[model samples]
Target: MQSRPMPQVAGVEHRYVVANGIRFHVAEAGAGEPLLLLHGFPQHWYAWRHLVPLLAAQHRLIMPDLRGFGWSDAPHRGYGTNARVDDLLALMDACGLDRVTLVAHEWAAWAGFMACLREPGRFRHHLALNIVHPWPDHRATIRHAWRMWYTALWEYPLVGGAVLRHWPGFTRYILRRGVTGVWQTPALEEFVESVRSRARAHAGQALHWQYVLRDIPRLATRRFRHQRLQVPTTLLFGEDDFAFAAQSLDVGGSHGVDVRVVPGGHYLPEERPDLVAATVSELFGTMESHREEIVG
Candidate 1:
C-alpha cells in the first residue's frame, strides 16, 4: 500500500500538562487502544506524522514532544532518564490511559526502555527503532559514539545553540545529511518544515545534548535484564543505518521479541512510511492473535 500523504489526518489536537514540574506538549489522533510514540532528539511528534494515521485507524495514538523539545517547556533541569519516564507516566495519567503500547526512536528509545524498567505493567508492548540497548559491549560503545556526535556538541552551553542558529539553512542541510537515498518530495519538505518550525527550529537541537550525556550504559545495565516482556515487543532497524554496528541489534531479541529490517537509513519512518505502517500493523495483529489463542 502506498503511504498516505503528509498531514492527511485532520483535526489533530494539542495539549499541555505539567509533568515532573515541567510542561509537555502532546499531539493526539484517533481513539482506541492507546499507542504512545516517543520521538528522539532533534525531532518531535512530527517524527511519527506518517505512522500515526495508519496506526490510529485501529489505535489511539499519542505523540508527545517531550520536555525540552518542540513547543514544550524546556527547563534547564530534570532532563534525566528518570524525569522523562515520570513525565510519560504523568502524561498518560493526564490522558486517562492506564496502559499503552510504547514506540520510540533514537534517544526516545532509551526513555521507553527506562519506562518499562520502572513500571513494566504500564506499557503493553515496546517498538524500538534504530537504537540498541546500551549494554557495556565494545561494539555497542563504538556504535553509540558513531551515531551520536551531535550529543557531545549540544552539551556545550552557548557554543552548540550558536552553531545551530548561526548557520542559516543549517537545519535543511542536517536533515538531508542524516538520511540516505532519495525521499519523496512532499515527505522531505514536510520533515524539513517540521524541523524548521518555530517551536522546534532551535530548541530541538539543544535537547540533543540532554539525551546524549545521559549515562545510557549505566541505566541499561541497571534496568534492562533477561526478564520476559509481559507484552509482545518488536525491534525495527534499517539495513543502511550507519548509526550502529550490526552487533547492536543482537542485544534485545533473545527473549522472543520480533526484529524487523526495513529499507533506508536511520529515518526509516519518514523515508519508508508504508513499510513502517505495514510492519507495525502486522506486529500488533500478531500480538492480538496470540492473546486470543491464549484466552481461547
Candidate 2:
C-alpha cells in the first residue's frame, strides 16, 4: 500500500526492508561509507531531499520513513524511543551495515541519542539537528518549557489526529514558520500538501502522542544522565527555533558532544541543507573542513 506521495530525487532508489519487525520504506542514493538520515516529526525521508544531492558524492545515504511516517508500515505499536532505536539497529543489520554516520533531525534526533548511548559502536558519529540532547539542564528546560506549547495540540491522541486530518493548516503553518530560512519553492509545497493525506498524517499524530507519553518523562527524570555518550556527536540547533531554548539544550560535560547554533528557525534541513551537508561530511571524516560557519 502506498503510504503517501513521495518526491523523486535523481539517483535515489526506493526500496523496502523489514527492520525491528516493521516494513520500512527507505530512499537511497550515493555510495560510500554508509550514512543514515532520519527525519523528524511531520516529515518523512523527503526532508533530506535537499541534502541528498549535496552529500551524494561523499557518502551512501539511507533515509528511512520512521515506522509510520512515510511509506513505512504504520503499525499501531513501536512509536516509543526504544522501539525506534531498535528499528535503527535492525535496519542496519538488514542492510549489512555494522556502523554508519547518522544525521537525525527533530524527533528522530532524540532517538538517535538513545541509539548512540545504547550501542556506542553502532554509529561512528551523529549530527543531531534541531533537537535537544538527553543531557539538558532541567532548570532551563522548565523555564523554557513554554516554547513547546505547540506540542500540546499534537501530544494528545484524538486532538492531534483531528488537527492533522482536518485542520492541516496547523502542520502547514508549522512547516512554513519553522524554517530558519525560506524553503525552496516546490519543496515547501510538497511538504504542505503531504500533511493533508490521512495515512501520512496518522503517523504524525501517533508519534507525537508517543513522545509525550514516553520521551517527555524520560527527559524530565534524567533518564540518560549516566549513559555518557561514547559516540562523537554534535547537537545543532537553530537560533530562532521555537521548540527548544538554546540554554535548555545544554549537554553534559563531554568533549565528544558539542552544540552549534546556526542562523534559522527549527527546520534546518530545509533551510540550511548546505550546513547540514557540511556537518555530515565533517562527522563522516570524508571531507576536509572548508565551509565557514558561525557557532552561535
Candidate 3:
C-alpha cells in the first residue's frame, strides 16, 4: 500500500532572529499557546513540517533550525549541550516568549531537556521523541555502534572539516543509513537537496556529528535528580527504533513518564506524523482539562 502524502498544513512564516550572536531561522504557524519543536541531527525544521499543522490548531507552533543546521549560523564553537540550551532560550527571548511547551527529537531532545533544567518554570511541559535520556556517562546502546563512528571523528578540529570537505559522499551515505525506514524517495530527496544547499554536502554532516558526540547522559542525570520537572511531560518512541530501547524505557519508568509507542523507525514524526499529532493532541487536551478542573 502506498503511504499517504504528507498533510498540507497551513503555510509557515519564516523569519530570522539573532540569538546569542548566531542567527536562527524559525518557521512559525498558528497563534495560541506557544509550542516549540526542536529537530535532530541530519535534519532541519523540515523534520517537523508534517507535524506543525496538526498541533497548530491549538498551539502557536515555533520550529527553529537549531544553531548549526539549515539557515541557522554554523559557528564552530558552542555546540555543546549547555550552549545549545542557551541558544534555545535566547531564541525564546528574541521572540518575546516567556513560557512554552517544548518538544524535541534526537539531539534537540537533549537540548530541550537541558533547557528545562536551567529554568523549569519557563517550560509548561515537554515532549521528547525518539531519544535516549541525556546522561553523559551512560554508554550508548544503539544496535549499530559503528554508525556513530563519525561522532568521535568530528570532535577533531582540522581533520574533521577536511574529511567532510574532501569527501561529500560520506555525508549522504551516513544520512541515508540514519534515515533507513523513515523516508520515501520524495522525502529523502527533499532532505538531501536541503542539506546540499547549506554548504558543501559535508558541512551539514560535520555539524550533526558535533551534536551526536555531546555529553548528554551526564547532564540529564544531574537535572533529573536535582531538578525534577513539575511540568506535565510525555515520551514518544518507536518500537523499532534501534537506538536506546532499554534506556528509553528506564527513563520513562523512573520518572513516571507518560509513554506512547508509534509505528515507525527512529524518525517517529516524519514517518508517522498523523499518529504523532494525534498523540500530542490527546496529551495536551488532557493537560488542559486537568488545569480547567483545578481552576474551576
Point to the candidate with the largest lDDT. Answer: 2
Per-residue CA lDDT of model 3 for 232-294, tens digit only, reads 667787776655463435554455356676666677777778877877677778879999999
N/CA/C clash count, model 1: 0
Candidate 3: Cα lDDT at 126: 86
Error of 2 at 283 (Å): 2.4
lDDT of 3: 0.68
Stretches of candidate 2 off by over 4 Å are 286-296
- lDDT score of residue 17 within candidate 3: 92
Per-model root-mean-square deviation over C-alphas: 5.0, 4.6, 5.5
Cα lDDT tens digits for candidate 1, 118-178: 6888987888787765442455566566665644544466656655545435555555655
lDDT (10s digit) by residue, model 2, range 225-294: 6677888788889999988899976655563678998887898888888888877766655322322223
- Models 1 onward score TM values of 0.81, 0.91, 0.81
lDDT of candidate 1 at residue 269, scale 0 to 100: 68
Order by lDDT, highest first: 2, 3, 1
